[model samples]
Target chain A: MTSVRQRLVPYWLLAPGLIWLIVFFVIPMYYMGELSLKTGSIDTGYQLTWAFSNYTDAISQYSTQFFRAFYYAGVATLLCLLIGYPLAYAIAFKAGRWKNLMLFAVVAPFFTTYLIRTIAWKTILDDSSPVVSFLKTIHLVPQDGRVLATSAAVIAGLTYNFLPFMVLPLFAALERVDIRLLEAGKDLYASATQTFLRITLPITMPGIVAGVLLTFIPASGDYVNATFLGGTNQAMIGNVIQSKYLVVRDYSEAAALSFTLMAIILVALIVYIKFAGTEALMGDEEEAE
Target chain B: MEGSSDLPPTDPESDQPGETAGNTARSGSGGVRLEGVTKKFGDFAAVHDMDLDIADGEFFTMLGPSGCGKTTTLRMIAGFEQPTTGKVLIDGSDVAGLPAYKRPTNTVFQSYALFPHMTLEENVGFGLKRQKVPKAEIKKRVAGELERVGLSREAKRKPNQLSGGQQQRVALARALVNLPKVLLLDEPLGALDLKLRKGLQVQLKEIQRDVGITFVYVTHDQEEALTMSDRIAVMNEGMIEQCADPETVYDRPSTTFVAGFIGVSNLMPAVAKGPGEIEIADGPTVPTADAAQFSSGEKCFAVVRPEKLTVSLPENAPGDQPGIDGIVESSLYLGTSTQMAIKVADDVNMTVLVPNASEDARQHLPGGGAKVRLNWLPEHMHLVAESDPGGSDADQTSTDQVTEGVNS
Candidate 1:
């Protein structure tokens, strides 16, 4: 009896988290799957008649919005990587006594609400604002052009909002890299640039993969940035799904579109993880030795 | 073995093959040289004005305790840290401005800093790859190095997958594959267990002999230094106390610091009496070698190895030998020998080691509180220079300097 109770202690410890996940994730996913295949208007009450055409119709009507969403998100993720990596590296390796202060500065903007921050970008990128006027003077923007509502504005906003997600993980990875390994690289005849490329970059790859995922996934599903900064021509799949649920009252199409977007992202994630080997995720296992 | 072919052909004269005759004019050898080298972190000097000359194919060791500047000297030779005011030369040429990568020296780091993500093959081949060696040659040399270190079967495995000893061997093969002019090892086996360290010590000496490269090793282990080094430089407080062969260093330590640091020695405070005698404080006058170096009434230490002293009953003690009477304070059974602490004076204690060669020897050994006479030949006693009055203060500051070196 004692041994049986001892064996059951682990399951007792696991109960709360398992129950929470099943209740919040599993049940909602099942309902969403059911609603995706139903056919009905909001007034008529949906019926699960296995209308597979709902998915095909949603894909055909909104393919352009889907492509734009992925494109914007991909560009934003790349921009975040370019801007965040050096900042994190400097903090981790070179900022002797000021490392904590710089790291706090990296996440300082989060004190403001995300919606308010995105709204603030609107005033900064206004037509006659100092930023746009300076760009116009430098011929980066034409004399008659504006910066308030464009694909660039949406990308810029997405990059700014998700940059900390890229930096913190990168800082963690770069900090764990042993200084002696860099010394060994130099002792083995690797130049400074070669040392960075061959040793530092490969070791920090897990952080890069994580940063890409964190920045790309949310940027793809976000409609707030597009709503505030992008014009009608830049409407992403997120904007279409928002209108499909609220304005059109097309419950079945919205559910199908959500499932479609999830399936594509899942496939893309699988392919990305395949190319970037799963060994990186398992790489943390061997460091303790 | 095919692995041995990759080693530089042993030129008994110079060790290196491409050196021109004119290049060896200044140093008269193809190895490393340091002239007036000093490394200071802010105001504290980690390595004081140091001068060293390591010959080709010599297995030299810098032995000292922690914070004794041995590692700092090794770093200066490896070009990791530049000397503040001196020149570091490799193979008879001044490499003052050369970076670590461009210098003809390599270091096996104390931590065995293997590239964790890379396989053993890649780790060993990294230097050759940086040198732009052809792919086929790189593969051949990498396999040769892995086989040389007995890690050929695990070439595809990463460092974390290997044991500590195996990772250390991989680190060795990685640096040796480059065929550097001088190989610097900063306490490479300092992390291993005792038995493993002993095994690797012999193996490392054999490898140095086979490669015939100048090896400058740094270690805090005195026994390891004695076992492997062709010559040992015993250092303390940012300066070398003595640099000599192992036997000379053991038999005749020049200073009290060297005598105490190298092995167990009973150093008794004494005042020089004449040309061949020193009077022990609160005890008897003893005959000593090199007593002529000190003036009468000069304060010094009379040093004797513990193994050189014999204990016997007062009646059985030899009449011709110098002897001191003491009471045994404690006895430790050390398997091969019985070590006893003898109280010779109120404040001075002397250690004596008696070999346990027979059952009768162990049975006759004195216990605690037993009175015994310690006897030794006159030649066994050595008089060392007096220790510094501010020695404890210097030790305290050197430790602080070491911490500062680590932080910087």
Candidate 2:
């Protein structure tokens, strides 16, 4: 009876959060799916025509925008991995006693509101600003082009915005890598480089893949960065969706685009999980680590 | 015979690889020597100036409580932790500053620390592969090592797929495949359950005998050390209290800590009544010449094992024998033998192991306290220098820190 009560305590505690998410989060997604299927005549209150054209129309009209956002998001995700992985490694294995302080430093920027932080980035990257002029003097910044509004700027914004997500998982994964395994690797004759390449990297791949997924999804759907950093030439699919709903007043087409985006991400997720989940050889490392 | 390709059972101490293999450059000729080896983390000393000489191909074990610096000493020998003050010589060369990878020695860590990314064969092959051995030789050697550990057939299996015992074998194979001068084991059987632990203890001794490599094992478990090691160094507070054979260490402990730590030794406050006689608490005068260092009436302790003390009724006891009369407080039946906690000196308790079973429950005495005689030979009691009469404070602050320093 006592064991049963102890077991029930967890379920009881989970009940509220599960219910709230189901009611507020899951139910809305369901309604959105329902909304995606309907056809409305504005005055008819809305009839469920169950028309399949809504899905096709969403694709044909926004193919270019969708492809561009995914391409930028993919680059941002890769860039985050390249930057976050080495930073996490240095912090986890080499930082020693200062690890807690370094982790806090990583989190400090996150405490600021996202929009405010991104808006601040606009002024920092102003083409006419002293910093940009200073960089141009050093031959670092391209003197001919402005960095404030470009495709590269959009990717840089996405990379900066989602950096924390990448760093967090990478830090956790690298932190959990057994120092003993590294010793074992060294003893087994692996050089420092070999040990990192063969053992550390493989063991933390799950975190790399997780970080990529987290950064890519949000960056792809983010209109804030595209609007502030990218000009008319580089507005992502997120901006297109926003324009369809608010600027063009095309709710049906917007809902169709949202559904299409969700489907593509869902399929990508299935594929990602297939490679980076159970078959990823992560849990095996976790056991020893 | 059909599954002969599986891991071969091993006794490393019996196998002679080479002086430069397991033995460090310090011990090129094959003997392991530690000269004033001291390990200090900041101001705290983990291993005090330790000087030890381990014979070639000997199963030497550093035995102690959890923080006694035995493992620290082992790690020093393995080059995982360099000695702060002294030199660690394997053959004849000093590995004072060399990192673990540069040293010839290899260690089987308590956690095994097997690379999960590698299969059994890959793990075993790792050391040789790192040396860039020829492909054919790596295959042959890896196969040979897997066969040695009795895991040849399971070479393709990941570490998690294997049992704890099998994983340990793989770890051993990984180390032995390097063929270091000395194989350092840091509580290798610590993670296993009791039954498995006992079984592995025998297997370890057997494997050491078969391989003939110098085995420097570190453990807090007395039985494991006693059963396997040719020489056992009992350590306390970063220093070796005693280094001798298991029988000598058990039979003749030089200090109060060793006598208390090795086995169940009943400790009692006693004074040097005469050369070989002492007045004990709540008991008749006992003869113990081993404690003659102290002058008459100076405070000391008589250390005697519980098994050495004979228990009987006053009537059945030898005529005029001096013994402490106590009652059997509780009798614990442990299969072939039974143990009883007897109250000898007031609230003081002593446990006695008896091989015979009692036909009837004799609990007629109040609180299981009955009149019984506790008798033993004069040589059984080892005289330990007692700092205080009560020894209350001695028991309060434990030797946990020293044990942790060595093991952790």
Candidate 3:
């Protein structure tokens, strides 16, 4: 009886967290999925019709917006990589005694409200602002220029917001590098550049994948940067969902689009796991051991 | 210093003795020379003015306790960590500011650090690929290296798929593929269990012999150092206490740290009684070793190796021979020999080793305070300062303090 009770104890311990996940995640996803099959109008309360064309209609109407969001997110993720990889490498391998300090600095901006931080960037991009004036001096900003409501600004915003996410994963990947492998590469008559390309870059692919996943998914979902900095031409997928629910008063369309986004994300994750190997993406201890 | 740069490494049957000497001064023996090398991290010195010459093809082992300077010395030689106050020369060239990749040394780290994504061949070929060697040449060299390390069949396997020993061999082959003048191994076999460790010890020695490359091996395991290295540099407290051939290091330690650290010894305090004689207690004069090396009134320690001390009954003993009285507290049959802990005087106990020969009487030794005599040859008695066992009390306690904690 005691042994049976011991087995039951694990379930008892796990009960609360499991219950929380089901209620918050599973039920909400199920309901949202169901609601996507229903129609919602300003005159009528939500009602289920099992009309699957709502998904088709949502896709057809917002195809341009959905594809544009993915393209922009992809570009933003690439920019994050271009900037983050070297920074992460520098911090991971070259910082030495200052490594902890560099890591802390990379993560420091996260301590504040992200919304407030993005707003500050909005202020800094104002035409009359000091940053704009300085950029103009450097020929980076044109006279009478306004960065807000521009597509470039939105990309810049997305890149900035996700830079830390990309850098952290890249740093983690690079830091786990066995110092000996680098030495081995050097010994094999590998020049320093060759070592980085053949050894360092390939080894950090998992980190690159993780960083892209983090940057792209969040950038695609982020309407804040679009609303604050991106113009009408630069509106993303998040904006499409928002407008569907508020302007068109189409809850079903919005629901359908949300599920569509979730599906694409899932597909991307599956593809990444397939190619990158699920083993490479596991926890550090698992990989190290 | 000694071997060809191009041909594959092999353990030549005729080269065994000279292989041990590693006098390959054709590249001429100046593989890594440290002159007063010291490394200080803040106020704590990891290596203190470490001066040593590692020959081009010498398989030298730097050995010590965990916090000692062995790893630091290896790092200095590899150009990973810079010495705060000295020069590190590689291949007779002062590479004081050279980065690790720029140095003529390659390291096989404790963790093999194999590239997880690459196959064994690709991993071995990585350095060559980096140097922009033709892919065909890279393939050929990688094949040769993999063959050398006994991993030719597993060249398609990733490091994760290989066994630990296989992974270690792969790491070795990867470094050797580069043809570094100096190959530094930093406790490379530490992670292996005892049986596997012993196997690798033989393999490493054989590989060093074959390659004829200067190998600077760092380890805390004295047995590994003694077995694999041409010379063992026993280090403690950021300094090389003694660097010599294994037998000389074990048989004639210059300091108490080297004596205790390398092998077992009974460190006992003895008063200097007279010339060529020292009193070890309320006892007859034990033959002295170099009384001139010590003042007659000063305190010094008398050392007796367990194997050197013969345990015999008083009646059966040589009539004129002098010895200590003791009772065998306990005895253990260790396959080849019997080892006994004998209570000599008061609570002080001395260990004695007896060969397991049938002619050697397996006298059932008496326990606790049973009278017995311990005798050894006159020249076997070695003397050093009395404080050698515990070292300087201040330094000992501070080491204890460092181990127990750090401010950080």
Candidate 4:
């Protein structure tokens, strides 16, 4: 009896969180799965006839939105990497006494609501704003062209919003890199560029992988940035799902779209993990194991 | 092994076939000369005005406690650091503006900073590949260097997969494969255990001899310095107290810092009594051969090694130096010898090392609290000018400097 109680202690400790996940997540997911297969109409109330055609219809009609969502997310994630890598490297290895301050600044955007931040970007890229006017003056944008309500603006918003997610992981990873290894690279007659590419970058691969995943996952299903900054032509899968659920009240189609997005993300994550190597995913504990 | 068939025959003496010969001129034979080199981090001088000349094919060591500017000096030589006020010349050419990569020098870091992501083979071949050495040549040289370090079997293993000692060998092979003119080792054996450090010390010396490359080794372990170096520079508070061969350094230390740091020394306060004699504080007057090095009544320290002093019955011939009467305070039986601490005076304690060469010698050591006599020949007494305390002060000041740098 005592041994059985001892065995059950671990399960008892896990009871709260496990129950919460089941109630709030697993059960809702099961109902949504059922909803995706049900034949539904508002006038006659919803009826469950196992209408699996809802998935096929959703995918065939909204294939463009699915492709656009992944494309924009991919480009935004790449931009975050190119921009956040140097920021993280500088803060981790080069900031000296200002390291803490720079780190605080990296996460400082979290103080304000994310929606407000996206709205601020919309204002900043307004047609008559100085930024757009300056871009026009520099001939970067044609004089007749505008910055707001364009795919560029939407991508710019996603990159900006997700940049901190990219930076913190990269910073944490880059911070653990030994300065001695870098010096050893130079001592071994590797140029600065070579040292960075061959030594610094490879050692921080785990961070890069983590940052890419964090930025890509949410950016793929995001709708607010599109709603605020992009046109109807640039609408993503998340925008389509949001309109289907609320504006059109098409529950079955919306449920099908949500499941499809989740499935795609899950598959992408698996492929990414396979390529990045499991040793990295396990982190510092890999050595002990 | 068949990878060499595709490459044309090439002379091994040529450092790198595709690269310009500028970096190869000093290959295999390079000497370093530092003229008035001083390094300053902000206003705190880590190394004072230093002038040192290291010969080609010499195993030279900069020996000092931590934070005494030995590592800083080594970094300057490796081109990782530029001197604040002096020139660092390698092979008769000043490399003031050259970066570490452009200089024909490699360093085995104290931490053995092996690239954790790369396998041993890739790490060993890194420099050659950067120089664009032929692929076949890279493979052959990498294997040879790995075998030299006795790690050929572990070539495909990542650095993290190997033990600390194995990783250390990999670091050594990585630098040595490049065949640089000068190899700088910044306390490379510092992180190893005693047995491993001792074993590697012999191997390191042998490899240096075999390669005939100028090795600038920095270490604080006096035994490591004595055992491996052809010559050692004893540094204290950013200044070199003495630079000499191991025997000369142990036999004739110029400064109290050198005498105290390199080994255990019985430093007793004394005053020059007259020609050929000096009187210890509240103790006996001891005779010396060279009283000319000091003036009459000048303050000095009578520095004598523990091995030089003998403990025996109080009996002496006429005209012989008088022995000190002391009570044995403690005796520690080290494997080959017994070290006894004798309180000669109220505050002065003298140490004597009694070798267990014979049964009779071991029988003569007295129990604790027993009276004994400590004596040494007049010629063995070394006179060092009284300087700021001794090694403890030098160690403490360097510690304070390190903490100050951190806190600021």
Q: What is the C-alpha RMSD of each candidate to the true structure, in Å?
A: 5.9, 6.2, 6.6, 6.6
- Candidate lDDT scores, in order, read 0.84, 0.77, 0.77, 0.85
True contacts kept of each: 0.87, 0.63, 0.50, 0.76
i-RMS for every candidate (Å) is 1.7, 3.2, 3.5, 2.1
Cα lDDT for residue B88, candidate 4: 96
Which of 2 and 3 is ahead in lDDT? Answer: 2
DockQ computed for model 4 against the true two-chain complex using alpha carbons: 0.61
What is the C-alpha lDDT profile of model 1 across A83-141, one tens digit per residue? 99999999999999999999999999999999999999988998979999999999999
Q: Please give the C-alpha DockQ score of model 2.
A: 0.39
Off by over 4 Å in 2: A1-64, A90-101, A251-256, A275-277, A281-289, B1-29, B271-299, B319-331, B341-351, B357-368, B378-381, B384-408
Q: Provide the lowest-lDDT 10-residue window in model 4 chain B.
A: B14-23
Query: Candidate 1's error at B230, in angstroms?
Result: 1.0
> What is the docking quality class of candidate 1?
medium
Q: For residues A1-289, could you state the per-residue lDDT of candidate 4 as single tens digits?
A: 9999999999999999999999999999999999998876767678888887898998899999999999999999999999999999999988999999999998999999999999999899999899999999999999999988888999999999999999999999999999999998888778999999999988898999999999999999999999999989889999999999999999999999999999999999999889998667656424821
Model 1 ranges with Cα > 4 A deviation: A285-289, B1-29, B389-408
Q: Which regions of candidate 3 are displaced past 4 Å?
A: A1-40, A44-56, A86-119, A133-139, A171-200, A272-277, A283-289, B1-31, B131-134, B271-276, B288-299, B320-322, B327-333, B343-348, B358-360, B384-408
Real interface contacts reproduced by model 4, as a fraction: 0.76
- Give the per-residue lDDT of model 4 (tens digit) for B1-408: 232211212334422222311233235579999999999999999999999999999999999878889999999988889999999999889999899989988999988988888889999999999999999989988887776676667789888776667778788889988888889999998887766777678878877877789999999888789999999999877888899999988888877777767777567888998888989888888788756789998988887788988887555323365577888998877657887888888866777878899878687668899877887787788888754635556434433432332243
Model 1 per-residue lDDT tens digits across residues B1-408: 342322333444423322321122122225888899999989989899999888887899999878889999998888788999988888999999788999888889899999988989999999999999999988987777776676777889888877777778889989988888888999999887766777678778877777778899999877789999999998887888899999888888887777767776577788999888889888788787779999999998887888999999888889889889999998877777787889888866787878899978799888899988998899888888854533444334433433332243
Q: Could you tell me which 10 consecutive residues in candidate 3 chain B have the lowest summed lDDT?
A: B1-10
Output the lDDT of residue B194, model 4.
67
Tens digits of per-residue lDDT, candidate 3, A1-289, equal: 9999999999999999999999999999999899899976858778889979988887887788788888878888999999999999999989999999999998999998888888988898877788888988888867767777887888888899899999999999999887767765665556678778877887787788888888888888888888887789888889989888799878888899999988988898899788877655763324433
Model 2 lDDT, residue B30, Cα? 62
Among all candidates shown, the one with the greatest DockQ:
1
- Model 4 residue runs over 4 Å out of place are A1-13, A42-47, A284-289, B1-27, B315-322, B357-364, B388-408
